[model samples]
Structure formats: C-alpha cells, structure tokens
Target chain A: MCLKPQHYEDILRDQPDIGWFEVHAENYLGAGGAPLHYLETIRERYPLSIHGVGLSIGSADGLDTNHLERVAKLVERFEPESFSEHLAWSTHDNHFYSDLLPVPYNQHTEDLVCNHIDQVQTRLRRPMLLENPANYLELNDTVTSESNFINNVVQRTGCGLLLDVNNVYVSARNCHYNALDYMKSLPLQSVGEIHLAGHAVDDSIPDEALLIDAHDRAVSTAVWKLYDQLIQLTGARPTLIEWDTNIPAWQVLLNEMVKADLLLNQPPARLAHATEN
Target chain B: MPQKTDFHSRFAQALQDPQINTRPLLKPTGTANQRRRFDVYRNNRAVSLIDNLRSAYPAIFRLVGEDFFNAAARNYIDRHPPTGPVMAEYGGEFGDYMAAMPNTDSVPYLADIASLEWQRLQSYHSANSPVLNINELAKIDSAELVNLRLQRHPAFSAIQSRWPIGSIWTICTSDAESATSPAEVDMQRSESVVVTRPGLEVLTNVIPATGYLFLNALVQGKTIGDAAEPALTEDPTFDTGSHLAGLVALGVFSDINFTTE
Candidate 1:
C-alpha cells in the first residue's frame, strides 16, 4: 500500500492489517512537520519502502549531488526495506521538468545511465531497483529495444528491477509491442518488487490509442490479468497498489490492496522449473 | 547520432516553447501525430507544476478564481520552472511572479496574500524546536534581562502587508458557509501576520505594527532592550513586558541567550 497524507489518520486509528507501506521519498524531504512526524509514527509499526519520483536517474547532466545527499540522509533516517527510482529523466541543464521524460536507449545513454546508477549506489551504499518507464512515444535516436536497454542496465550495474506492470501494459499498447514478450525479455530474476497502477487512454489520433500512466483510478482489468500472469512467472513478489491522483477513500485503497494480496497468496499455475536429464 | 545531452537540450527546449515543432525530435511521423505525442509531456509538465503551486497557494487560487489563477500560473510556469525536485520548495518566487504580471493590478492584494500563504507553508515545514516559556525568564537577573537576546523559533515568521492580508487570507481559507464576504474587507487597512507551528497545526495571528517591528528587530539579532527601542519609538504606549509575554505564549521565541562577554 502507498501511504498518502489523507490516509495518515485512518492508518493511525485503525492500524489496518496491511503488509507494509511505500512512500514517495521527496514528500518527506522537509526539515520537520506533520508529514515527518506521522511517517515516524507509522514507520514504528509498518516496514517502509522509499520510492523516489524526482531523482531523475537518467539525467544526462549527471546526478545532483545536493539532492542525492538529501535522499541519502532520508534513507538513513528511515532505513527502508528497499529504495527504488525510475529509468526516466526529469531534468536538463538545471531545470527540473517535474515529469518523467524518456531517454534514447543507445550506447551513449546506456553508458550515461549506468554511470549515474553507479554513483547513486556508491553514495547510498545500497542497491536500488530501477523501474521501467511508461513511454508515450519513441525518440528518433533509439537503436535498441526497451527490454534490451533494461537488461543491459541490470547486467552492467547489478541493480534490481521494480517491474511496474501497468507501465508494461501502457507502454506496450502505445508503442505497438506485445506486453507478454516485453516482460519475458527482461531480467525477471532481478525483480525485487512490483508496481500496479491505473492508466487513462488518449484516443485523439484516428485509428490509434495511446494509454497514459495516469495513476488516477482503479487498476484496469487488463492490468490485473497481466499482474496475475506476472505472479505466475515471478512467483509472488512484494506488490504495491499505486493510487497517486484522485485518491479515493481509505476503504477504497485498502480494497485494492486486499485484491492484490489475494492474488499474491494463490499458488502459481506454472512455476519456473528446469528439467534435468 | 545526437549525443545524450544534445537530445536532452533540444527536447527540454521544446517542452517549454510551444512554437518549436517536436517533429524534429520524434520519430518521423505525420505532423499532427507528432504533436499529439509530444503534447502529453508538455501537458504533464505544466499541469503538474501548476497543481503544485495551487496546493501551496490555495488562498491565491481562490482569490483570483480558477481561470485567472491558471493563466497567471501558466505564465509564471514558463518563466520560473522549479530548479529542484522538492515540490514543497518549488514555488518560492510565485508571489513575486504574480506581482510582476501586468493585469494583476486589478487585485493588488493578490501578491501580499500569496506572501501570507507562503509564510504559513514555511512555518508548517520548518524544523521543530523547543519553545521558550515565559517562566524561563524568571531565572534571569533583572538587570541582565534587558540585554538578553531571544532566538526566533525555526517555524516562526512575520509578514507585514499594506493590504488587509490576514483578513483576506482567513476568508479565502475558511469554509464557504461561514466565510466573511470579500466586500466586507477594508482595503485601506494595513495588516500583518505572525505564523507559528509549535505543534502539528499552523496558527496565523493578526498582529499590530509594533509587534512586527519588535519581531523584525529580534530576527535581526537585536537584544530585547534594543528591539524594544524601535517599538517604543513607533508608539509611546508600547508595552514591551506584556507584548513579550504574548509572543512567548505564541511560541515565537525558541530560546534566550545572553552575551558571554
């Protein structure tokens, strides 16, 4: 479950039966306030996973040392079970765009992303899980497939994957690729956690559909099917129900969590097993 | 092949500038299709930042109404994109930005209202500290008490505005059912506010001119006696003793330190 400020009182009062909670690292970066105060209180009970939305890990300008230091301090204070960032960039020169922009997946970008990941890992003294971005359009400079790009990053940097299934579904539909094939091509063995969220469709172009990773509603039926299929392959990972926008009531989010929890507990239809002669 | 930075520079420029065609950046496609694809990012960048500003300055948003606030926000967005990832610290210049916009003179108090809201936000997020109690001053010697310097709480801030900012802010932020009408506001009156969040909830107190002067002097590292001089000069009947006690109750001062020499 993702912790939102609106749900703070509910969580504190009910002490709901949740596995753990995830929080956007940037929200708690302030000096002191009700946010930090409640986070500390909640963390005392539930395990925390810090997911950063603004790290801009793929920025070509290298990492922002000042922002990196602040994130490092936050991680130390919380000591979350895992820390994750996106494979997209949100900054150029010195201006932060506040939206995850895609990076061309070629040799130059591969090297740049790997170097930035290495710096982040070294500073934090921990391995970070890199998430696959939800792409709306492909850049002209692309020379490799998205899976290959992610595989190469994992191979070179040894960072785990935060496999967002909704992104896979959204990007696959938008970029004209098979979601199953794309998911299978990646380094599934490195997946440390999973993310499931909602998306909105933009059907403006004639005879075309583009799905935006809006995260503003309930997980779509197709996304749920994909999640179930993924659990069969990956064999039950820590899953999060991400409802960032148009956040519903506490009961609504908890219901979504319960749905994922039910799927997580079910036996995988076909386990990954190697045959021996 | 364009280098990583080159691609980023061009892409970033296009996101901000509407006239620049993204066809040059995207994979070759129909002109309309290229624009439709690129509009997603452009819209996300603008809407997300605007939402951040709206959350930070709800009073400003309500004062100007949605259409006007969004226009001002869009103009401000182009000129002042956030320099970092911390959204809470992103709109530090929006008040000044709104003040500089041309047609904002229609609501001259908009900028000062923004400052009051910004101060409240700063008070809510600033570091927490142990507040100084009035009883703490009893330990000090009477002769040395006047020479004592008081440290302002990390979450304490004072704003002096020409418009009745405090009243306007209260009406804008309060529930609509009980909110005072805008016509009831006295535009000629000068208002000041002292924001403090000694606990979880932030409190905004309407203050007088002498209070602002005394607090400003303390903020500049002036001793109690020196700070009182200005307040006394402003109003002959200024009572430092009771005024200091009131501020202490409000948790304005965090600590009292005396010059070691």
Candidate 2:
C-alpha cells in the first residue's frame, strides 16, 4: 500500500495488516513539519520504500546535483528498504515540468539514462530500481524497442526494475504493442517491485483510445489481469497499489490492497505447469 | 534525424507552447493522431501544474471560481513552472504574479489572500520546535523583560495588507458549504495577520495596528522594550502587558536569546 498523508492517523491508530508502504520521496523532502513527523513515526512500525518522481534519470544534460543531494539526505534519514525512480525525464534547462516526459529509445538515450542511473546509484550508495515509463507517443528517432532499452539499462547500471504493470498495459495500448510480449522481453529476473495503478482512457481520436496513466481511480479489470500474468511469471513480489490522484477514503484504498494481497497468496498455475513440464 | 538533445529541447518547447507542433519528431501510430497524442503531454504538463496551483491557493480558487482560476493558473504555469521538484515549495511567488496580472485587479485583495495562504502552507510544512511558554516569560524579572530578545518559531510569519485580507481570508478558508460570501467584506479597511503553526494545526490571527507595529519591529531583531515603544506611539491605548501575554500564549516565540544593545 502507498502511504498517503490522509491515512496517516488511521495507520498509526490501527497499525493495519500490510507488508510495507511506499511514499513519493519528494513529498517528504521538506526540513520539518507534520509530513516528516508522521512519516518518521509510521516508519518505525512498517517497512518503507522511497519512490522519487523528479529524478530525471534520462535527461541528456545529466542529473540535478542539488536535487540529488536532497534526495540522498532523505534516503539517509528514512533508511527505506528500497529507492526507485522513473526511466523518463521531467526536467531540462533548469526547469522541472512536473510531468514524466518520454525519452526516445536509441543508443544516445540508452547511454545517457545508464550514466544518470549510475550517478544516482553511486551517490545513494545503493542500487535503485528503474521503472519503465508509460509513453503517449513514440519518438521518431527510436532505434530500439522499449524492452530492449530497459534491458540495456539494467545490464549496464546493475540496477533493479520496478515493473509497473499498468504502465506496461497503457504503453502497449497507446503505442500498439503486445503488453505480454513486452513484459516477457524485459529482464524480469531483476524486478524488485511491482506497481498496479489505474489509468484514464482518452477517446477523442477516432479509432484508438489513448490510455493516460492517471492513477485517479480503481485499478481496471484489464490492468488486474496483466498484474496477475506478471506475477505468474515473476512469482510473488513486493506489489504496491498506487492511487495518487483523486484519493478516496482509507477503506477504499485498503480494499485495493486486500485484493492484491489475495492474489499474492495464491499459487501461480503457470509456475506449476512450467515445473511439471 | 534530430539528435537526442534536439529532441528534448523541441519536446520541452512543445510542452510549453501548444502552437509548436511535434510533427516528424513523433511517429503517429496507425489510427492515433500525432498531434492529439502529443497533446496528452501538453495537457498533462499544464493540468498537473494548474492543479498544483489550485491546491496551494484554494482561497483564490473559491474567490475567482474554477473557470477563472484555471485560466489564470494556466497563464501562471506557463510563465513560471517550478524550478525544483518539491511541489510544496513551488508557488512562493504566485501572489506577486496575481498582483501584476491585469485581469485580477477587480478583486484587489486577491494577492494578499494568496500570500496568506502561501504563508499558512509554509508554516504547515516548516521545521518543528519547542515553543516558549508564558511561564518562561514570567520567570524573567520585569526589568530584564524589557531587554529580552526573543527569536520567533520557524513556523511564524507576519502579513500586512492594505485591504481587509484578514477578514477575507477567514471567510474564504471556512468550510465551503458554510462560507461567507466575498460581498460581506468591507473593501476599504486595512488588515494585518500573524500566522503560526505552534502545534499540528496552523492558526491565523488578525492583529490591530499596534500589534502589527510591535511584531514588525521584533521581526527586525529589536528588543521587546524597543518593539513596544513604536506600538504605543501607533496607538496611545496599546496595552503592552496584555499584548505580550497574548503573543506568548500563542507560542509565537521559540526562544529568548541574550539581550542586544
């Protein structure tokens, strides 16, 4: 379950049955106040993972050293079990757009992303997980498949992957690729965590509907199916239910976590079949 | 073929200006329109930033209504997107932006209200510290109290406005369902407010001329005795003892440093 400030009091009061909680690292980067106080207190009880939204790991100009330092200090303070960042860039020319922008899959981008990831890992002194981005439009210069690019990044930087299942489904739909085949091609063995979230479908264009990784509502049935298939391939991993925007009540999020939990406990028939074969 | 660096610059340009098309830079899928596909990035960039401003300035949103706020916010986001990643620290200068915008002149108090809201948010996320209680002030001899140099808490901020922003802020920040309308405000009056988060919740108090003068002096590192002199001159009836006690009880000061000459 992703820890939200709205549910801090409830979690502290009940200490709900869950494995661990993930927080957007940027939200807790401030010097002090209720966010830090509550996070520190809650962190004492449950395991934590620091997820960063602004790392810009794929920027051509390289990483923001100042932001990286702040994030490094936060990682030291909280000592989360894992730290993760996106494969997309959100900042360039000293201006942060606050949206994860896509990067082309080519040799230049592959080198730039790997170098940035290496810098982040060296600074933090811990290998971080790089999650694949949900692309709305493919860049014209792409010379490689998205999966191949991710594979190169993992192999070069020696970092794990935070496989966001919904991103796979959304990118697959938008870019007209097979989600299962894309997932199968990646270095699934290096996947450290799994992300399941909801997306909004934009259908203004005639034939195809573009799926926006909105994270605003409940996880769709299609996304849940993709998650199940991935789990079958990767076995049980530290899965998170991310509902960042239009956050609902505590029970609503709790129900989503419970659903994911039920699936995690079940044995994968595919794994059984593979062993039987 | 555009270089990787060229792609980023052009994509960033497109994200900022909708007029610029990403055309050959983006490959259009079979049925998907490239412009519409690229608009998702544009829309996401603008909407996400606009939503951030809306959350940061809810009172402004309420005063101008969503349509006006969204349009104004779009302009603001285009002009000044955040330089860093911390969303909480993004809108420090939005109040100044609103003040300079020609369309917002009708609501004269809009800028001050935005400042107050920004101050409240900063105080909410500011560093925590142990507040100095009134009992601490009582232990000092009356003579030494005159020489007391108090350091304010990290969460403390003082805002002075020519319009009745204190009253307007109170009305706008109330439960939306039961909020008082902006028509209730007396547009001619000036107001000052002290915002502090001594505990978990932030408190905003409207201060009189005397109180404002006294707090302003202290903010400039003046001694309590020096601070009170101007307040007394501002209003002859200024009761220093009572006002001091009130500020102390509010936990406005975090520590009493050594007296300065």
Candidate 3:
C-alpha cells in the first residue's frame, strides 16, 4: 500500500500481511536521519524493496555511479527482498527533472538499457527488477515490441520484471495497443512483482487526453479488470498499491490490499503453457 | 551510432524542451473529454516541484499567496533545475536563489526565511550518530586537550543572519495568526540559529553569538582551548560550563580526535 513516512510505525504495529514495503530509495539515502532510522527499524520486520524513480537508467550517457553507489549503500543497509527501477530516464545534462520519461523500443535503446541494468545489478550484486513504463506516445516503426524488449533484458541480464498492470493498461490505452496482447507477450517466468496504481484523464488535449498515472484515486473500474487478467496469467505474485501524491487515509490502502488478496487466492488457468524451447 | 543518444536526447527534450520532441507518444484514443494528453507530464512535473517546495518551505509559501508562489516557483525550477536525483534534496540552494531572484525583490527577508527553511531541511536529513558522551569530555585532561579534532552530528547546522529569521521561523511554523512586522523583528540585531535533531524530531534553537563562534571553531580543527578564544572575544561572560552541557544534551558531538601539538 502507498504509505507515508509518518505512518511507518503505526502501519507496522497493525501489519496486515504486506508482501513487502517499497520505499523511495532516495528517502533513506542520507547517511543518518529519522527517515533512515524508521526505514531500518521497519526493514527489521518487513520485507523491503527499493523502487528508484530518478536513476535515469535508460539514458544514453554512462550510468550515474554516484546514484548507483547511493542505491548500492541502501541495498547494503536494507538488504531488501527485491529491488526495482523504471525502464525510463528522468534527467539529462545534470538537470534532474525527476519524472519518468519513455524510451523508444529499438535494438539500440535495448542494448543501452541492458548495459545500464547490468551495471546496476553488478553494483548491488543482486537481481533487480525492471518495470514497464506507462508510455504517453507511440511511434509508427520500431525494431521490437515493448514486451520483446523486456524479454530481451530478462534474457540478457537475468533481471526480473516488475509488471506494473496499471502502467500497461495506461500505456495501452494512451498508445492504442492491446493490453492483453502486451501481457501475453511478456516472459511470465521473469515476473517478480506487480504494481497497481490510479490514473487521471487530462483535459487540455483533444481526442488524446493524457493518461496521467497519478496514484491518488482508486484503481479504476478498467484497471481492476486488467488486474484480474494479469493474476490469472502471472499467478499470485508480490503486489504493491503505490499512492505517491494526494495520499488518502490508511483505510483506503487497506481496502486496495484486501481487493488484491481476494484476487490472489483465485485459481489460475489449468493448462500451464509448454515452453517454446 | 550517435542516434543511440536518441533516448537520452528525446527524454531530455520531453523534460526541459517538450516542443522539440517529434517522437510519437502513445496517444489515448478512447478518453478525451477532460484529459489533457502530453501536458500531463508537464503539469505533473510542475506540481511535483511546487509540492516539494511547499514541504521545504511551508512558511514561505504561507507568506506568499499561492498564485505568486507558483509563478516564482516555476521560474525557480526553470533556472535552478535540481542537480540531485532526490526531489527532497533538490532545492538546497533555493534560499540563495530566492535572495538573488529579480522578481521576488519585494520580500527582502524572503531569502533569509528561505535560508532558515534550507537549514531546517538539512537538519531533517543530516547524519546524526550518537553524541560524544558528557562524561567522555570530562575525561580529557589539560595535557591531552590540545589538537583535539571533534566531529559533530550531521544533523547540526548553524545560520547567522541580520534579520530575526529564527523568530520569524518559529512564529511561522507555529500559529501566530498575523504577519510579523520588521520593526518587531529587530533586524538591526544579528542572530544565529542552530538546527539539530536530539532524538527522532528536528529542533531549532537561537544561539548566542558566543556559542556560534565557539561551535564554529570546534567544527573546524580548533583545539578546545583555541575554540574558546572566539566565544571569549564575543562574550566576556561566556560560560563553557553550561555551553558544553547543552551540546551534549543536543547530541551534537560524536567523538574527539586528538593529535600531538
């Protein structure tokens, strides 16, 4: 569930089967502070995952060692169950515009991203999860599909995939791709966790309102359906409800967790598809 | 190929120069009544930056109207993009930026207030290991006191200003209701404020000029005896007795490193 720093202890006091805790790795990157203090305390009890949004992993330039080292230290300190980052870049020329920007699906970009992922894993010395970004634009030509690119990364680096269901649904709707087709194409075996978030509709642009992945509201009627499809496909995996901005009360998140728990227990398809190999 | 930089270039353009981005983004065909498309990223970035500023400087935002604050904040972001990846640590130089801001010239004290805010944030995130015990300091003899190198908590920082920035910060964070006046501020007087985290929470206290000088020296490689020179010059009545006790109480000192004189 999307948790506030203030709510760390109280949430822990009443732990309700949270699969793991996802913290903005930057929050605890400092050498010493209560943020780190509480996170360390919580890490003692709950399984933790570092979800970084600012590493700019997909950038063409060399990977940010400073950022990597900070994340590395956090990994060393927390020793989280699984760590993850986006398939998007957030900065250029030192100006840190901390928002996830999409990358084109092509051989060159894949090669670049794979190298970045390799560096991250090598530094942390653990398998990290790469998430599918919620794309806002789609182009006519590409060397590979989004799922194909992800599969290649998994094949290359042995990194796991954090399939953000809401992101896929958002990207698919914004870019006019089949959400089911995208999920089906993914290497389901590489899937480690799932993220469910809320999105908002933009008002300015006509015929193409921005599908903002703002996690303030409830999982849309559409997203819930998509989640069901994913669960049946990927089976029960670790799930997180990420509400970053406009965080609602605690009960709101619990409700979402309960919803996910209900879906997890449901049986998967009887026939496990044979490997292509 | 140089085209490999396409991801980097396009992502950069999307961030600072979205207009240059000819790259086709996923267009949402179904929903369009109220949803703004590409503008979503821009709005989100702006909102995120502004929200971060609000958290960093609630008092300043409170002082300025939302409209004015936002307008200034947008300009601030354009000029001083965050070099650090962490958004909370983004506006480290915002106070200095605001002071030199051509537009925010009206609120002369705004910069000082921003300085106070910045210090508070530093205290919030600075490293605070266990303090050097009071008994530990007492163990040092006159013979071993020279060349003592002491390190303080990372959560500790001192800011001295002409304006009553500390009082203004105190009043702003608390519920004083009405706006503070400069005449009431005694801006002609100099003030130094130290921000530290004794426990889990951040605490800010106004320090005497003597205390500021003394700590400043100690933070440097000054010997305990050498550091006392600054405080004695600043105040003839400077008491090392209660002063050292206060530092210990605040979890300021970490350890004492000594070298032969």
Best by lDDT: 1
Worst 10 residues of 2 chain A by lDDT: A268-277
**Segments of candidate 3 deviating more than 4 angstroms:** A140-143, A203-208, A267-277, B1-7, B18-36, B135-150, B175-184, B221-226, B233-235
The predicted structure with the larger lDDT, 1 or 3, is 1
Q: In candidate 2, which residue pairs clash?
A: none
Candidate 3 residue lDDT tens string, A142-221: 55788888999899999999999889998888777899888989988888999999898764555555577888788887
Question: Higher-TM-score candidate among 1 and 2?
Answer: 2
Model 2 residue B155 CA deviation (Å) reads: 1.0
| Residues A1-277, model 2: lDDT tens digits | 9999999998999899889999999999887889999999989999999999999998868899999999999999999999999999999989998899998999999999989999999999999999999988878889899999999999999999999999999999988889989999999999999999999998876677889999999999999999888888888899999999999999999999999988887856765553233
DockQ for the candidates, in order:
0.78, 0.77, 0.48
Regions of candidate 2 where Cα sits further than 4 Å from its true position: A268-277, B1-5, B28-30, B176-181, B259-261
lDDT of 1 at A44: 99
Candidate 1 runs further than 4 Å off: A268-277, B1-5, B29-32, B138-144
lDDT of each: 0.89, 0.88, 0.77
lDDT of 1 at A58: 85
Give all TM-scores, in the order shown: 0.95, 0.96, 0.87
